[model samples]
Structure formats: structure tokens, C-alpha cells
Target: MPRNVTTAVAGVVITVCAVAAGAGAAVPGKLGTRDGYEDAGGPVWYWPVWFPIFAVALAATGVFLATRPAVHRPAAAVAAVLAAQIAGRAVVGVRDWFNADGAGVVDMSQHELATVVTVAAGIALAGTVAACFAVALLWREPARGWAALRPRSLRLLVAGAVVAVGVPGVIALAGSDAIMLAGTVALTAALPWGGGLAAAAWLGPRARKVTVRTVLACAATTVLTFPVTMLYLMVSHGYDVTSLFS
Candidate 1:
């Protein structure tokens, strides 16, 4: 893949990591509650909303990594685990919805639904942790196939992803009882810009070699525009960000 394409893929990794991390971050405190519907539910079951992006991003990352001059076995292993978690979560999210009714409408409590969602999300977290390990393993030796980053730069990369993903969430949650709502809403808001920035940051130097404009365009396309389009559905149509199967 081209440098721009690779950078774009990195943006997706940022998004997925944010989604997975954000979800994992939220679940610990609220995992076992019956009332963990809104904020908790959002993180527990937000996969339906983010899954397509996650899927596409994962595929892109795999392709990009494979084609890189060197391959980091540990990172590849971690990526594979992340892929499984996401894939499993996607499947289980659908399964929960299907269980709602054999062939008709079935009313279910948010609590009941949350149990299933949280369990699946837990599995997803395992996948993400595996990916983190991969990132770590590769970082120790970039030639092993890990994308190289200066120590200071790697910290900056992580910090950037967190802020870009978290700031909007804090704003959204300020007055709401629904932390889940806050997270989902904020994430919806954050994705485009956050993902874009992450893409640019990760690929910026690599892309510099390819052409700054092309790099920027790819970053913008994957990060900014795409998330905005996704967020628009929720804002304009009253889309529920937490509906597991929607």
C-alpha cells in the first residue's frame, strides 16, 4: 500500500483503539449492574455503531502491516487478537438482538440486555489488550516490523489519541446522568477529528515522502470526513448510538 494509504489505515487503528479503550475504560465500574443501561450500555454495546469502521480498519492494518518491509510477529499476533475480539463482539451483539424474539418483537430490559453486551465487550477488551502487547513488543524493536516512533513521540501519539477521543466525551457528560450516553455521544463527536489527527500524526512523516497533500487528504478522508458522516446519522435522525443491533 502507498504511504498515504498506510497512514489512513493507522487512523483507523486509532479509532478502533479509542473505541475499544473507551469501552474498556468505562466497563470496570459498571459491568455488573442491572441499571448500567445508558453510559455503561453505550460502552458495552457500542460495537454495532463502530464495528464497520473497526472491521475496515483492521483489514487495512493487516494489509498494511503485511506489506511493510519488515513484519513484527508480536504486533501481528496482537493485531490478530484485536481482530478476533472485534469480530466476536460483532457477532455477539447481533446474537443478543436475535435472542430478543424468535421471529417477532420482544421487549427486554436494558439490564438484561446489558449483561449480554458487557460480556461480549469484556471479550473485546481481551482482544485489545493483546493488540497493546503487540504494539509494545514491536516498539522495543522497530525492525521486527513494528512501526517506529521515538519514545517521546510514542507518548505524544498516545496522548493525542486520548485527548482527541476524550475531550468531547467529557463535554457531553458534564450534565448528564447517562455516562453511557455521554461516552457514545462524545465518541460520535470525537471520532472524525480524533481519528484524523491520529492518522496524520502517525503517518505524517511517512507521508511527507509521498507528498504532503496526498497524505493530508488521506488523513482527512479517513479521520475527519468519515466520522462526521457517521455522526451525522445520530444527530440528524435521532439515531440511538446504543442500540446493539441497529
Candidate 2:
């Protein structure tokens, strides 16, 4: 990625971290049912929206660390984003700790929840970065053996293989109530880019690089993942699949 592009991406990370932290800092008391804000039947189910936020941020950080970017210098920008995430989480943790209802053990437990979640994210990022620093890194663009296949089959196999892994996130997001959204959305969204990149990179003699066509197939599969996720989540929830059309 270009330096400018890296900066923009870093800015996005910082912005998201800041916004989430700033929002959490606004809580005047420990979050729990004691405030009359929630109950056992609600969507919270022992996990709040922050769980997804942390999951996604950490996943992206790991992706960066595991795959060496085309340009190495911009890798440092990931650290800045990590810092912002930690700082923001710290603020939320402190805010929650002081404001928690000490007499209520249920509410008190959450004081460290923010801290623990961010710590996991930090470990994921830090560990990956350390590994990248130590090992012979891979470009993460093209998968091995896909391009070696005959030209005619490139579209069928190359795109099919990559798109198969990330189908559920697309579907889960469509589920009823608060929605089954998660930080894992990268799975489906990745098809259009990952498939296209793999197809473009396998420029060896046995095969020619195909662009938009491969992308279209990947895109179709990407669309398929969404409905699949929705169907699974709906059926699991006991929702009538046919009722959606009604």
C-alpha cells in the first residue's frame, strides 16, 4: 500500500478506537441490570457490543502482522493504531472501575471486562508483530498451487477455494434482533479482493491472469455466504425461513 493509503488506514483505526473509547468514557456508572437498562432476556446475553468491536480490531491487527505488506515502512502505522486502542480501553476500564457498584458483585465484575478484552486484543497484535519480526514473512497475496491448474479451470477452483472459508459472517449479520453481526465480517468481504488478488498474482506460464471474471465468481459466492448465514442463524433461532418472504 502507498504511504498515503497506509496513513488513511491508520487514521481509520485511530478514529474507530477513539470513538469507541469516547463512547465508553461517557458511562456514569457500572453497566448492569441494576440501572434498569437491561435484563436476562435481552440481546446482551452476557456480552455487549464492545465484544464485537474488540474482536474485529484484534483480527485486523493480526492480519497485518501475519502478512507483510507490499511496502514495509507502513507497518509501523499499525502500532499507532494499537496504541490508540489500548489508551481508549484504559480509559473505559478506569471509568467503569470507579463508577461500578461495589455493593453489587454483578456490576463489579464488569469493571475489568474492558481491560481483559483489550488485553487479549493486545496480545494478538503484539504476538503477531513479534512473529513477523522474527520470521521469514510471506506476502499473503497468492495461495500456492491455485495458479498451477489449467487456465480454463482457474476460475472454478481458485475462486471457489478462497471464497469457501468466509461464508458465515455474511449470513449471520442478517439474523433477527440486534443482528448476528461481528468483527468477522472480513470473511465474505474478502472474496472480491482476495480472489481477485490471487488470480492476478498467479501470472505463471501455465495460466493467464483473469481479472473481472474471477472477481464476479468470487462476488457471487460472497453473496451466497450472506444468505447462508442468515438461513443458519434464522433456523437456529427457530425462525420460520419462509416467513421472510411474507
Candidate 3:
């Protein structure tokens, strides 16, 4: 397949899977809720239908992980990290579900739940970074002539950052609390592609936009924001890094 074709296809697959996975997480929470509370006290993150989402997410993340890691190695690495993060979340959610009581309430307090999930996120982030690094160390050096930063490229990047930051900010400033939270969740899940969309807005030549560099840039910038988003969520919940455990 053409490199362009694979990159485009992979991006679309990741995007569709992202939306589907989110629905999987959310729909189950709504399945048997009472005023938004579920078996786990507050619609625990994982439920029976979560797999369908995970399966689709797995497919999206698998694209760059498969036979062409060398073609878009940065994207492959990002995909790996995304997969690990999702897996970690699923693990904690399922663990909590199994550990819940007869009343379907998890034994841990809300603070404890936050702390554990935060810890899990940290582990997932660190572990994936290490693994990607190891793989890069073993892989052959990439070919020379990486695209140079040009005037237009710099502008595109700046604009992209503005868009990436602006989307969530706009949602927060404009929406009600419930809407803001939902928008944030949906945006965060899009990750690198959200960044890519920023790039696409500027580089909209249907034939020429989806290059390796753009994809990697978008993936790198967007995924880096994940940590920031997590931090924001913690603060929004009125918990500090220390407070979660305190």
C-alpha cells in the first residue's frame, strides 16, 4: 500500500475507534443507572459493554503497531502509549468492579478511587514511554532529510497549538458543567488526531496533507496534553496531587 494510504487509513481507524470506545464506556454506565449512579456508586468506568469499545480502540491502536512501525514510527509509539493507557484504565475499572460489594459500591472512597486511577495513569504513561524508547533503540536509524521547519510550517504548528488549546478552553468557557465535562472527555480521547485536525485545517490540499511529519507532530503534541488534561481533571474535582491520598 502507498505510505500515504496507510497513514490516512490508520488515522481514520484510530478516530472511529476512539468515538466507539468512548460510547462503550459511557453507554454501559447509563445502562442501569439511577439518577446517574451505577452499581459502582457512580457508574464505574468499566462495565460489560466496555469490550466492544476496547476492541475497536485496539484495532485503531494496532494500525501503526503492525507491519509498518518504521513507516511512521512516532505514530506507532503514540499508538502504543494510547493502547497502554486505555488498558490500564480498563484494568483498574474491572478491578474495582470485582472488588465492589453486594451493594455494588466499591470499598474505596472517592478519594481512594481517584488516587488509584491516578497512580495507574502514571504507571501506564511511564511504562509505555520506556517500551517505545527500547524499540527505537533497537530499530534502524531513520533516513535523512527530515522536513525542515519553514515559515509556513511554523505558523501551522503555532496555529495547531492554538486550536488544540482553544477547543477545550472554548468548551469550558461556553458550556455548562455537564457539557464541559463531556466535551473534555470526547476531546481528550481524540488525542494526536485532534492536533492533526489542526494541521489539516491549514494544509487542506486533499492530495498532500497527511505526511509522516505532520502526523507525528500532531501525535506528539496532542498526546503530551493528555497529562495536562488529567491534571486539570484532578483539579476540577477539587483534589490536589497530595489531597487524593490525604
Q: Each candidate: what lDDT?
A: 0.43, 0.39, 0.43
Q: Superposing all C-alpha atoms, what RMSD in Å does each candidate have to the true structure?
A: 11.7, 14.5, 12.7
- Cα lDDT, model 1, residue 95: 55
* Highest-scoring model, TM-score: 1
Span of 10 residues, lowest total lDDT, candidate 3: 28-37
RMSD of 2: 14.5
- Give the clashing residue pairs of candidate 1, or none: 38-180, 39-179, 39-180, 72-145
Candidates 1 and 3, the one with greater TM-score? 1
Off by over 4 Å in 3: 1-43, 47-66, 73-119, 126-147, 151-159, 174-191, 197-246
Compute the lDDT for candidate 1: 0.43
User: In candidate 2, which residue pairs get closer than 3 Å at backbone N, Cα or C atoms, i.e. clash?
Assistant: 171-229, 171-230
Model 1 lDDT tens row, 1-246: 354354345434534554554354233222223334444232222333344444455555555454552543322432433444353443444454445323323333456455555655554554454345434323333452543453323543564476566775566656766564545433332443343334334433433222223223333444555565566535433357668466
How close is every model to the real structure, measured as TM-score?
A: 0.38, 0.26, 0.37
For model 3 the local lDDT of residue 138 reads: 26
> What ranges in model 2 sit over 4 Å off?
1-110, 127-136, 139-169, 172-182, 185-246
